[model samples]
Target: MSKIKLLLAEDEPALGQIVKESLETRDFDVTLCADGQEALQTYTDHQPAIVVLDVMMPKMDGFTVAKEIRKVDDTIPIIFLTAKSQTSDVVEGFSIGGNDYVKKPFSIEELIARINNLLNRSLEQKNADTLKIGEYIFEFPKQVLRFRESEQNLTHREAHLLFHLYKNKNQVLDRSLILKKLWGDDDFFSGRSMDVFITKLRKKLKEDPAISIVNVRGYGYKLIC
Candidate 1:
């Protein structure tokens, strides 16, 4: 199998070295950069398979770097590595097409698992055919979401979660099942993260009165049609 290429952009030298070494030991080809500018430059030059970018940096912020990267390539996976845990920051990261986010002081094992999960999910999405949920039509290959006369462009996670729910439409999906399947974890934190995405999805599908993403207390969620 071909080795995965990873771009790790961190401001702290010690942390950067540690992450780089850990990834290399896992058989990944990692390119480490110290700031956002260099990270963007390296990304453009190397076109790594994935990127792990720090939010706060010297030259530029991680969100800015992510925007620059998205301008050049729309599909390469991006995982934000930041110390900020505020909901707004996380939402901003997702707005910029972030595939995942790893907070600072995080375990290397969790980081590796997230990287693998994101990559695997990206691959799976690339191979999906199509999915239909309630009144919405999800065309994975075309990357288009259609609902009646209104059509919305979705980010990667939106598409993935919608399709997965469609595949199991009308059934209640446990919180843990949805989390691990979509985000590689179902812990308290990931559970909260999933809630934000769920709210976003609900807003997008609000036009369809027949469709509902109901939260089942202590159980999971039901994508009712």
Candidate 2:
């Protein structure tokens, strides 16, 4: 199989080079750009399978680039890289079609994992028929979660979290890994935010007796069925 194509749009020269080299080492074919305008051009020309963009960039912002990309193709996975910790920043990234977000000073290992996870999910949606978890039926195209007579339209974050947990059902998911991928940071504040989302998700899935989202003490969480 061909290497997965990636478009990386980061303005910081040193950091950009580091990310470019790191992704290349992991066997990804990456096209690097220094700003949103260049990034958008590269994305249009190459049609990469995935995108890694910095929210703060010159000549346009990551959000604008993501919007342009979405106009052409809504399926490509886009991950935002930013340093901001504000809740509004996170919400804005998601509102602009970002598949995931990573904060500044992140580890290469974390970025690699996010890329792999997002790509795997994209591939799965294209190849697999449906995901059946306990009594809930997940429909990827429609982004819907249905159980019995009730249904909820899942936001992108909710859908991705549920899918990840379902894929690893009955297995432990590291709290750090989840917080980083879902909220961009694993600090105390972000941890609390994640906890809130987890509670909401648990309540949403409460109708199904076979499903359980449990915290595994200080290590992580386990979604069992």
Candidate 3:
């Protein structure tokens, strides 16, 4: 059996070694980097199935690396590890493209679990890759939404947001549920970021007049097709 490939970026020497070894024992092919620049390069070179990044690294921070990665590929999951516990840090990580955030001094078990959860969701999404949203064809694994000959590449947040709304099509997808599930919080910043994603999705699907992502005022959103 081929092990899952994971990219881990941490600046602390001891912590990096321990994490790499721990994940390896669990049958992951881990490409460990000591800095954000190396992490970004490794991702570009090999494109791992999932990425684990430390926030404060030399050359580039975790959020910065995530931003770069999102430009080219939005399907890969990114998890951020940091000592910074400020809500702003967490919000920034999510707004920029992080799929999960873990604070420093975390147990390896917690990290492993989170990694597994993200990968499982990724696999499920791939299995149901093609969805017809009105006249648009949404390919989740490829992060492409197509209407006729026109194709739009969606960001990570946008793709996931759309997926959730599609899953609850014609029903009210609660605002709190989306904010918590996608951004990791229902805080003000996360809420605002979610609004941005929804607006973008609206535009992307606008080409198909039969589709509309309607705001439910204080309730949530509903995908009408």
Candidate 4:
């Protein structure tokens, strides 16, 4: 059996060493970094299966590091460690692609549990076959969207976004939710990218007169079918 690899970034030397040693003992291959810049570099070099980041660090913040990582890989699980536990802070972490969070002073046991839980959850989510939305048929596995007499091929992101829209058909799917779920970040560029995909989907589904994906102002979009 192979050990799971994780990149851990913490500015505090004592805490960083403790975490690295602890996880190593539990059969994890841990790469420790003292700052966000180093963390990002190590991440690219190591290609770890999971990432553990501390929110505050020298050079760059963990949130920034996570954003950089998200640009290349959206599905990798990210766990954040921070002393700040305000509601807004937690939301920001998740909005920026964090899979889980551990507050300062957290026990190693708790951290281990969160890490295992995310790893398990990652293995459990598998997309289903197809969906019937309005007058169109979506073959999810094949990334095909079909309307009468016409069919459109979809990219992986396109197919995934369409699945989310279909799941929330007739209801508003928050733009932040879309960005976070697909792009793994709700930053400006991610939002703009999502807008492009929305435009693409609109064009693809336009033939179905009964189906429309409308932008719900500042909140998000609604897929009405």
Model number with the top TM-score: 3
* Tens-place lDDT digits, model 2, residues 143-204: 68889788888766677677778777899988898776666567798788778878878988
After superposing candidate 2 on the true structure, give the runs of residues whose Cα lies further than 4 Å from its correct spot.
1-38, 41-47, 54-56, 67-75, 79-121
TM-score per prediction, in order, is 0.70, 0.66, 0.87, 0.63
- Candidate 1 lDDT tens digits, 118-146: 88876876666666666777776455788
Question: What's the lDDT for all of these models?
Answer: 0.82, 0.84, 0.90, 0.85
User: Per-residue lDDT of 93-194 in model 3, one digit per residue for the tens?
Assistant: 887878899998999999999999999988888888799988999998777899999989987678888899998999999999789778889978778878
Tens-digit lDDT string for candidate 4 (110-216):
99898898787554433446688888889875678888878888876787788888878999999997776666567787789889999999999988789999999
The residue pairs that clash in candidate 3, if any, are: none
Estimate the overall C-alpha local distance difference test score of candidate 1.
0.82
Model 3 residue runs over 4 Å out of place are 149-155, 203-210
- Pairs clashing within candidate 1: none
Task: Report residue 194 deviation for candidate 1 (angstroms).
Answer: 9.9
Ranking by lDDT: 3, 4, 2, 1
- On the 0 to 100 scale, the lDDT of residue 105 in model 2 is 85
Better of 1 and 3 by TM-score: 3
Clashes of 2: 0
Query: What does candidate 2 score on TM?
Result: 0.66
Ranking by TM-score: 3, 1, 2, 4
Pairs that collide in candidate 4 are none
